[model samples]
Target: AVLKATGAKGVAEPAAVLAAGGGRLLVKKMKWKNVTVAIAEISNPLSVSPNEPAL
Candidate 1:
């Protein structure tokens, strides 16, 4: 798998969400050329948004 070959975890579509801390999928997998992408909304975001400013 990708993680095994690249030593990078969660580079694949199926594992993307889980890698992002098990959130809902905002965007499904899309493929183009030699790339695959997915977007996930983390259940617990670790950082405050830039617009919100840190407290």
Candidate 2:
């Protein structure tokens, strides 16, 4: 199966690998003040990466 991850730490490697396999990588920032919650409005942003596959 394909792999997935989120946030800054997950922006590389896995994202590239998944994209290379024809997958979109969804990324969002986690809110750390109160709890671990997503508070961003982003979508399949891996298209900019050199190794990511085209949409």
- Judging by TM-score against the true structure, name the best candidate: 1
lDDT of 1 by residue, 22-46 (tens): 7788888777887888988776776
**1-55, model 2: which lDDT tens digit per residue?**
0133433443344544444453443444354555443222224444467686543
Give the runs in model 1 whose Cα sits over 4 Å from its true position: 1-11, 46-55
- Clash pairs of candidate 2? none
